[model samples]
Structure formats: structure tokens, C-alpha cells
Target: MIPHDRPVMAEADIAAAAGMELHTWRRRHGSDFRARVPVVNPGERLRLYDQAQAAAFLEGRPIPPAPPAGEPHPDDLLSTDEVAAALGTDASTVRAYASTGYLPHGTELHGRRYWPRHVVQARIDAGDQRHHPERTGAGRQPGDPRNTAPRGRRTEARVQEVAAELARAEGEALPALTADELAQRYAVSRRTGERLLAAAREYLQQTGRGA
Candidate 1:
């Protein structure tokens, strides 16, 4: 028995009766609603999606950034010219040093020679003075007064005793004993012992006793 002209309630009117607007109710509680929806340009949608995925995967984690471009490693080898520049010397001097075993051997790459930077620096710091023996009294000329000495049987016996003692203690054959060890045994300073040992070893080597 309804009247044919009566107005039917619209969905909006029904929602209003329930204390909400239909559009707002659908936006907030609709079964098909989405939260935090992104609005990206068609051209940028893929990029945005990739970024979102990366961010989600990396959440609560930290990663180190890559090294800057063109940075050199600490252990990188250096050229001979580079080594000379670092040591404040000429390339010829570097070669001479290398020949005398004062410096580490260099490598040839693509027909160019190079030395390790750290190895060169370490040898430099070690005060390797093998290149200039004349400056260190290590190259006394033949027939020099320092080469001649008063020979006595007692002196010969003492030298042999000291040499044997050093060889036994170190378990190695000695062209000569080190100054520090000789000084400890002789109750003398290292410098004095070094002078005496140098002279004795030189004489012994000349005589082919400990060659």
C-alpha cells in the first residue's frame, strides 16, 4: 500500500542518517579503499615503484657508500720517477740504490718500471746507506795504513776466540760479529766494539781466514 509518488532514500541520505557522508564513509572504510596511495606521472611510475621497493627492503638497515671515483689505494705501486720524486732524489740515484740492494726490486709493467711506494719509503726510513760506502769508512782503499797491523800470536788467538764464541752463540758462520753483541761480551760501548770488529774482520777477510 505504498504511494507511487513517494521519494526513495538515496545512498547518501542513508549514510547521512547513519551520521556520515557516503563519499567520506567510502573513502575511510570502503572494502576497496587503499591507504598511502601514490599519485605518479605515467613516465615516472616505474621509477617511483622501484624506489619504494628499495626503501622497504632497506628499512632499519644502514649501508656504506661506495668509494669516491679516482681514489688511490695505499698499496698501489709507484713508478721509478714517482719514487725519485717522493724520495727527493734523481732516477739514476734510485737505480743505483736498487742495484746495491738498498731498495726493493722494481717491476716492469707494459715496458715501464715501478716500485711499491710503501717498500721504497720503508727502505728510505731504514737509513740504508749502502750506496755511499766511501762516506762510512767501509771502502778503505787497498794498501791503506788502516789495512796494515802489528801481527802477534796472542792477538791472533784472541781474535779467533771471539769469532768462535760469536759463531757458537748465534749458530751461524760469521764474517764478523755484530757490534752490539761484541760490546756486551767485551764490556765496551757498541761504537768502540764496531770499530774494533770492523778492523779485525777486514784483516781476517784479507787473509782468507773467514772469507
Candidate 2:
């Protein structure tokens, strides 16, 4: 019996361990095998199976039950759907937060970002009424500094400052700041970060410093 802690095995590797050709196993019992042992990674080109569960399925033994699905451990990596559930919001909202750099940059794996349970909980504890302004029970004020995006001479001054920083940067890539990094550094929105980067790049090019 394979130990639960053993590393997951790919389908081909599992077939090789069972002394069956990969094609033969696929033709005969592939569906049954997959149905019995949950695929640890579903969307990847190569599926992986938990070693113990795969072993149990191959041996015609009862497969162990999947882990309970309620509360997750602090260290557990959670999908956007899981995060949505935890936050009492929706997956779209979670994705938006992630895209906007409002959430901590989580681990990216198998073409999906999985945030640690603790980080999601921390966001919950911190409360994001600013992000969801509707919860504030008041319409957005036109004069609100946050609503009135930064512009005019002050913005141009910042652009010039960032462009100077770009000139000082030693890398081949000028303005060495990603949109997300710029947002965090300047305490602005992701959209503002993009605008600042664009303006800075233009400023650098106009001054012949970026070339």
C-alpha cells in the first residue's frame, strides 16, 4: 500500500508501476481509474493522482475518502471559488481583487492563482469597504480625492520624478517598475499605476533618457 504522504503519480507513471502499457490502461480502465482516484490537477496536460488513492484503485480496494470541504487550514491553498465562499462574495469579485493587486500576490500553479487561506482571512479581517463603496451607504462624492483621479501639474511632476528614476535605473528596462509595484509604491490604484507608467515612459522618451 502506498503511503498517503507519497508524491502524486502521473497517469503514465501509475500505469508503468502496474506493469500495464499506458495505452492499454487508458483503453481498458482509464475512466474507472480516474473516477475512483481524484485527479490532483484537473486542467493540466498531465493529470496527477494521489499515490495512495491510485494504489487503492489499482488493488480493487476501497479508496480513501476525500478531505472534508468546509473550513480550510491556514496554510491551505485556496482557489478563487474557495476564496469567494470565504469572503461571502463571488468568484468574479475575487478575480477582480486579484487582477487589481488589491489582494496579496498568491501562488500561481496550473494556470490558476491559489491564495493561502490565512491571507484571504486576513483580508476579511481587515475589511475592504473602500474597495466596495456600496457598503458605505452613501453615493460617491464628485470632489472625493479618490474619485477625482490624480491629474494636472501634480501628476506631471510625479511623471517627471518617475522618469528621473528611470534614467537612474541601471537595467536595460527603464522605469523598472511594474504596474502592480508602482501601485503599491505610490499607494494608488492599478489603473493609476498603468497611467503613471505610460506617462513616465513618454517623459523618458521625450527627454531622450529612455533611448
Candidate 3:
């Protein structure tokens, strides 16, 4: 049976549960492991961990014990005031930073801003990820987890070339093939296919129709 209900576990079991190689786990958290966890059997080299505490440490969060009955617990979403406190600044300053794209991912609702505590904290730890003009979009920044593009692949030029080819072949009318068919036809990944189609649509919208 799995040791799912047992919160405190042996080192190897903890590593397996966390889906990490033992060596990697040891290397990453060696100091903390030694300091925080108890040695179940020093003679037999058995180390133990509280799964919740270990998981929090592995994820780079604070390792404090659970809050007392009356104390408030921290939430994942930090309000503008909470974020300001974390940054050693004021709420208004945080709003300005968010407006200028200097802060990490945030959402605005009912005129109040909420930042992902971990994301913003990570950025602060790495020294504020400064705003880059090329990264801003309607709702997200380039460093967002969902905003990744494949590395070392430049497809805009080729997409434009394909658009021109289709333009000449069809005479001012873009091809009707859907994104999936275009992916299969051009041997590009679905994401690249979508980009190509988007470029084609923009081209057609601005000028005449294309691929």
C-alpha cells in the first residue's frame, strides 16, 4: 500500500513522493534537510521529514509551522497593499509599477490589483525583472509561464514567403485550409501553424489576401 496517509517519511520515500532524484533533492536542500529534519536512526542512516514542510521547502516557500488557531494564514493572491508591503513600497507605487509592466503577473478587478505572491516574490528575489518594451501585450508579459515561444526558430520570414506564394497561386484570395491542415501541409508544429495563420490573416487584413 502507498504511504499516502503518513505525513512524516524516510528520505528515499520523500524523494520518490516529490518526483525528484535523491541526489538532486539532496544537493538542492542538503543544508535545510540537515538542519530542519530529524534523523530517525543515525546508526542506520535513516532521515525523516514532515511531508508538508518538506514540500514547502522544495518549492522555495517559507517553512514555518502551520499558523496558530487565531492567526491569519497567508493567501496565494497578494492584494496591492500586501504586495506593497512585500516590496518595501506603497500600494500606489505598486500600481505604478504594474501599470508600467515592471512587476510580475497581476490581475485588475473592480479597480483593485492582485499579484501572485510566489511569482512576484520570485521576481523580487532575482532582482526585479525590469520592464522590456518588446514583452508587453494586452494582458500578459513575455516572462509569463504561458507566453513561451520555441527557441531558435525564426518563422516570420518563411511565413511571409508562404503567404506570398499562396497569394500568387490564388490571386488575392487566401487559401481556405484550416490551421491543422496547414500544419500538416507545411510540416510545422501546431503553435507555429497558428502563428503562420495569424500572420497570414494580418497580411490579408492589411493588404490583399495571402496564405
Candidate 4:
């Protein structure tokens, strides 16, 4: 029982009360929120939180009741339905894989095969990423959802900026910036800078300003 005077709770208690994993709670409610909760430690690794703040955070939120003691964590074992939804495949396919000992899991739980989350994800990652059953024919097609180009008035402005950066280097012994330098300046990847330079050169040529 918590002492009424202090009413401090640990991180584990917070997680249990919030129905979330420790990491999940930390991710969703970061340092700023943690400060609001007023987590404190007197040079110790263990953090103590104010119970009032924690209760306030969960005041209006609806959370499912925690499973009975001795049950496994919700994340420890995943149902075939969950695995199917995650992998974008049907349950039967996942079941078939599990039946053939493909899924890295142990015995079934409550009449459903429970795949170890990490193992199932590892196997899925090792396989083809574009092998979703519903997207077989459209995976490589243009206008495919995956390949849609960025659109908006900002595109032309971006292209102009890249062109200006390139033009600043014309007739100079050293270029205005290398691809890596441009990437750093614009916060884009080096490959993106290279592609932008290529497109900028084309745009300049079309505008009769070719270098």
C-alpha cells in the first residue's frame, strides 16, 4: 500500500495502471509529460512518480482490465489473425505456414496458434516485402500506391532552389556544394541531392539556361 503522505508510484506500477508497456508509455508520453507527472529520484536509478498525476492522466481514458495474474504479456504471443493483419496476408496462409513449422513459435494457446512476435516478424522480414497477396499484380505498376510521387506547389519551389544552388557553381573552379554538402544544407539524403541535381540540370536545359 502507498503511504498517504508521499503517494509515490514506480514505473512498473504506472504501466500496470495504464495498461501499457513501459516503453510504450515512455514513447507516447515523453520527457515533457514525465516532468508533469513529476517523476523523481534522489541519485538512484529507480524513479518514483506522483500517484495523483498518474491517476489524473488516466482519469477519463478507458482501459481494458488487466489479465489475471500468471498470464503472459499481451505482446509475448500473437494470434494468427494479428500476424495476418500485420503481414498483409490471410489467416489461412499464416496458418499453413505455422502448420508446416514455418512460423517460429511453440504450442497453440486457447485453440489458436500463438506465434512468437519477434520470430514471426523476423521470418516476414527475411521474405519478400512486396509479396502481399492482394498486391501481386500492382506491385510494379506505375501509379502504384507505393510509387506515388510527391505533389504540391512546393515541388516547383524546391526544384528552383536546387537549380539556384547548382547555378551558383557555374564557371567557378569549385562547385557551390557537393551532393553531400547540399544534402546537409537541405536536410535531404545524398541520393536525393544527386537526383535533385540531375533534375535541376534538365530543368535548366529546358529553360535555355543549360550549363
Please, what is the whole-model Cα lDDT of each candidate in the order they appear?
A: 0.45, 0.64, 0.52, 0.53
Tens-digit per-residue lDDT, 172-206, candidate 4? 22235467765654445899778767778888888
Q: 67, model 3: CA deviation in Å?
A: 13
* Colliding pairs, model 1: none
In candidate 3, which residue ranges exceed 4 Å CA deviation? Answer: 1-75, 128-211
Clashing pairs in 4: none
**Model 2 lDDT per residue over 5-81, tens place:** 33567666777778987777777888888777877656443456777788888888999975444444677667666
lDDT of predicted model 2? 0.64
- Winning candidate number (TM-score): 2
Residues 1-211 of candidate 3 have per-residue lDDT tens digits of 0122334555555566668766676677566776875442243212445567667766668775732233222335566666767776555446546544567548642223467666566657776443222434444444532233333233554455446545533531224545776565444577877788778767766775632
| Candidate 2 lDDT trough over 10 residues, lowest sum | 138-147
Give candidate 4 regions above 4 Å deviation.
Answer: 1-75, 134-211
lDDT for predicted candidate 4 compared with the true structure: 0.53
- Give TM per candidate: 0.28, 0.43, 0.26, 0.28
Per-model clash counts, in order, read 0, 0, 0, 0
lDDT of 1 at 165: 41
Give candidate 1's whole-model lDDT. 0.45
Whichever of 1 and 3 has more TM-score, that candidate is 1
